[model samples]
Target: MMWRKVKKFFSALGPGLVTGASDDDPSGIATYSQAGAKYGLATLWTVIITFPLMAAIQEMCARIGLVTSVGLTTTLKKHYPRPVLYLMILFSVPAIILNIGADIASMGAVANLLFPSVAPIWFSLVFTALLLIVIIFLPYAKFVNVLKYLCLVLLLYIIVPFLTRPDWSEVLHHLFLPRITADREQIGMLVAILGTTISPYLFFWQTNMVAEDVKVIRKQVMVNKRMIIVAGNEADPRAREKRVMGLLLQKMGLDVNLGMLLSNVIMFFIILTAGTALFPKGVRNIETVEQAAQALRPVAGDLSYLLFAAGVIGTGALAIPVLGGCLSYIVSEALGWKGDLDKKFDRAKGFYGVIIVALLLGLLINYLGISPVQALLYTALLYGVTSPVIIAIILHLANNKKIMGEHTNSRWSNFLGGITLILMTLSAVLLVYFQFFNRS
Candidate 1:
């Protein structure tokens, strides 16, 4: 019975796990590491606060997909004004491609740390090409499962934090109690962490994946009902009702809320790991994931270093595909092209073409001699600025009765989402203030 339950649980896990794991991409790792190294637990409070906000936003995205059977872009294109949809995608696609470039660079940096002789540029190009091939050719189900397993590498962060033997009382105090030092560098790092944690790609990916899952569910349900009808007597209404209810329960058992909670818990541990391992050592400067991994060496030993490196590489692999695929989804939706991973490449020519172009462009960006660290920072700032518009559209779509039907966001969801929108608004304000005003 226990084994059966475990199998069932594994079978049900998909969109939530993938979205959560993608949150810890190499750039995100750098942001979290910088937060810990710069202010220790001072910025740790944001992690706890952002958990529910992440869930609320993602849940709305999921709800939009499940109810509308359309991706966010597609829905926006149909329901919202064209100008609004175009404006959102205009900011979103380039930002996503830039992020892919950063992840590629970060992955190469990790590989270079391990090998020391491999050139970062060569490794980045090779990695990007390999990722594009895998995502473009591989079956969608297989690609998703591969990403789920890659998430296991994140456990290294969990283990590394414990090995550091951080002061528990101090960790708790800093986490629950906020601190502000009035330092610009510290404030900048805080904003970066917030931007990284609550990203826009996750929003697009989560909604589209949810739509994909619903498509699968709907197909399975139709097939199952046909099978049951054939197996039962034609006049047996009771048997038909029983079969339908069983299917409903099976679908509901996925417990999406619970999955979101588990994902947020993993995120909390990541922030905790960085807070404990790098924060107290006065290592204030970090521009790369490799640096964060190396910082774990003396404090958490060789195993920790290996673990951090593995996490970076694995998460990078998981995220690069989603980043590429998201751009594909947005463009396809904008241009009125059919887009679904379940559909064959030949059937969705424009969709697959967009994915290929985005991936290739991302790969080319690495060879352009741009510093990946600066690219990552710029990506964060870009997403920070663009997130408010996306959030506004999402809230408006999710609340529209014509789109979500009965699955429109609940009162509580709207309340939380409104609050999240406000928080993002403030973060964007601070980001602009620092970027332009404070720079002088």
Candidate 2:
């Protein structure tokens, strides 16, 4: 029975798990590594503090998808003015492309470290082409399964912490304590962590992915002659629909909570590994993933260094597609064009077009001579600047009864999401302050 339950849970895992894995992409890895190496485990509190905040916001996005039967942009089109939604699409597409650019470059850099003979540029082109092919040709459901398996790559980070032999007492104290400095650099790092953690790309991705997941579920229900009916409220058709949605939401809660928990666990361990290995020595300045990996050598051994580098490639491979997909979904929805991954390329030309064009543009960013670390930091800062508008819109949608129907966010959901909104708002505020007013 236990085995069957486990199998069922794995089978139910979809967008949430993929999103969680993508959260730890090379950009996040870079930010967290910088945090650990520069500030030690002091930023460890973010791993815990952001879990509920991230999970809550994502859960709201998922519910919006499942309840509304559309992607986030589509829903926004209904409630907000056309120009507002368009501005969102405009801001997000470029930002997501930049994000994908950074991830691809990181992947290539890692490839170079692994295969010293090959040029990183060649690897970058090859990997970019492979991602395009897989996402373009594979059926959506199969692609999702491919990502789920790819997430296993995250296990690499989990093990590296063990090699460091960290002091459990200090680790525990740091985990629970909220230690922060008002120094501009520390504030900037915190904003980057928050931006990378609760990202705008994820807002669109989760909403759309959950919508697709529900469509698949309803199709299965139809095959079973159930008409997607509810168990409890069969008398009223709309109410029965609401009940059925409740069931979907319940399952989604499990998947999302597990995914977010897993994402944060990986985050915590990665920071811990870097902190234990790098901070005690005098090595604090790590600008790139490769640099951070090398910094681990004196304490964690050469094998750990190689594994750390490989992880950059793995997580980047997982993340680039998500960034690309979020762009496609936003543009496809904005254009009122058919766009579902399960649909054939011929059927979803606009959708596939957005993905292809976005990926190609992202590929172009590599040759522009921007270092991967610079790209990563630029991506974080952009997200930090834009995340507040997205979060406020999300909070608005979660509370709106007309859109979510009977599935409006509960008080607890509102509380957590409210916290997320305040946090992101504060980040934006500090970003403006440090960038402009504090230029001294």
Candidate 3:
């Protein structure tokens, strides 16, 4: 009975779980590892703080997808001005492609670490090809199922910290008591962590995933997707539909909360591992996933080293799809092109074409001589600059009765969403100032 319940619970978890796991990609691993090496456990508080904010924002996106039966990009195109939509695409697409590049580079570099004979670029080529084939051939449901299982690979991080036996008391202290400094490095790192955790690409991806999932569910409910909710009928049919939607929203909330919690927990442990293993040894500057893994060999042993290196490859595979998919969804939706991962390549050429182009471009970043670290930094700057606007738009969309109708944001949702908006805006400002204007 217990096993059955557990299985049922996991079965219900879909896009939210995948989204959360993908957030902790190779680039994010480098950010957390850098935080640990540079600031010790001082940054651990960020994981705790970001959980609610992340969940709230993602939930709003999910809700928008569910109510409208369309992706956020399409909704924006319909209701908002053209320039606003273009600005979103302009800031988001390049950054996402750069992120995909950094992840591909990191995956290749880490693969080379495990096997010295194979050159990193060769590994990058092989992995990029493998991802494209898998993404293109697999049906949407099957591909998502594969991604759900891939999320378990993050368990590697949860185990690495335990191998080193960190001090429980110190970990607890940093986890609760927020510790930050005013210096540029610390501020910039803080912003990077926040920017990475709550990204703009994720907003587009989550909304699209929910939209696709709803289409799938509606098909399952009956022959016609329109049966799930009747907009004009305010009597029994609409009321019954609202109840069904309420249950779905409840489940979605659980999935998003659990997924965000898992993401943050893995994040906490990655920082902890670096803090315990690298910080005390004066190995502070970790710019790449390879450096983080290599740094752990002596202090955290071969097992820890192996796990860290392997986790990078797993996360890269998991995350690059999301990165590519987000960009594809944005472009596909904006252009009124048919896009669904489950759809055959012949059916959705523009959709899959965008994904293929993004992957190929990402795979070329290493050959272009741009370091994974540099790609991530540029990605962070762009994400920081653009996320506030996206978040603001989501808040507006979620609360707008015209779009959402009766399924608008509750006061609690609005309160949390408001906080997320303000915090993200402030972080973006700080990130820009530190990266460019603030020399000191």
Candidate 4:
């Protein structure tokens, strides 16, 4: 019975888990490492704050997909004006490209750092090609399984921190206490943390993947049944809808909470590892994931450095594709091009075309000479600025009962999502001001 239950649980894990794991991609790994190395657990509270907000907003995205059988952009077009939709695409796609570019470059940089003989550029091109081909050709079910294995890389962070032997008492204190600051640099790091943690790519990816999940299941698993009308055909249609929605919501809730919680827990551990290993040694600043790993060697141990290096490569491999897919979903949906990842490349030519274009554009960033970790921070800043707008749209759409029917957000969902919006908005505003006006 227990084995069956466990099998069922893993089977239910889908876009939520992928989204959560991708949240801690190399960009986040770099950000969290900086927080730890520079501040020494001082920023641990961020994970505490972000986990619930991330989960709530993601749930709304998932719910939108489940109820409407469409991605967020499709839902946006349904309810909003064409101009509004185009403007959003204009604002977000560039940000997504910047992010994907940075992620691709960083992934290559980390891979190069691990094996100096293999050039990072080669890694970047190869990774991009592999992701594009796999995502375009592979069946949806198989692709989800591949992503699930990538999630295991995130577990490295959880284990690596123990090698540093951090001060648990101090780590716990910082983890619980909210640290408010007016220091410009600290504020910048805080914004990066928030932005990278609950990012715009994730918002797009989660909604689209949920729709894909429904599509795959209906077309493949439930070959003889139409899931959309499954509830309506029941004896008590109203109750049946509620029951079906409840099951989906419950499963999604479990998947999302587990994924987000894991993401933040990994965040906490990364900070702890950095703080314990690098902060006291005055090796605070790091420009690449390689540097962080190298810095930890003498301070933490050789094993710690290896694990850190391995983690940077693993998570990068996991995340770079997600950044690509997120943009692909948005672009295809906005243009009314066929946009299902589960379809063959020939079948969804425009959709895969956008993905290829995005990845190819991302390659140009590597030749521009920006350090990989620095580029990651810049992307986080972009995410910080762009995500609030997306989140606001998500919240607005999630609350509209006309779009969601009876599946609109619960009061607690609204409350938590509200907190996320306000917090991200404040950080984004401060980041903008600091960059343009307060740069003294």
lDDT winner: 3
- TM-scores of the models, in the given order? 0.90, 0.95, 0.96, 0.93
lDDT of 4 by residue, 194-232 (tens): 887888878888998888876665574357645446555
lDDT of 2 at 158: 89
Q: How close is each model in CA RMSD to the real structure? A: 3.4, 2.1, 2.7, 2.5
For model 3, residues 1-440, the per-residue Cα lDDT tens digits are 98787567667897899989999999999999999999999999998789999999999999999889899999999999999999988988889999999999999999999999999999999999999998999998889988888898999999999998999999999988987777779988888899989998888888889889888888877875464444334557767687778877887788888888989999999999999999999999899999999999999999999999999999999999999988998998888998678699999999999999999999888889899988987998889888889999999999899999988998988998888889889998898887789876
* Higher-ranked by TM-score: 1 or 2: 2
- Report the candidate with higher TM-score, 3 versus 4: 3
Task: Give the range where candidate 1 is weakest over 10 consecutive residues by summed lDDT.
Answer: 246-255
Candidate of highest TM-score: 3
Quote model 3's TM-score.
0.96
195-293, model 2: which lDDT tens digit per residue?
A: 878888998999999999888877887788464344563677767766777677888898888889888988998888889899888689987787888
Sort all candidates by lDDT, best to worst. Answer: 3, 2, 4, 1
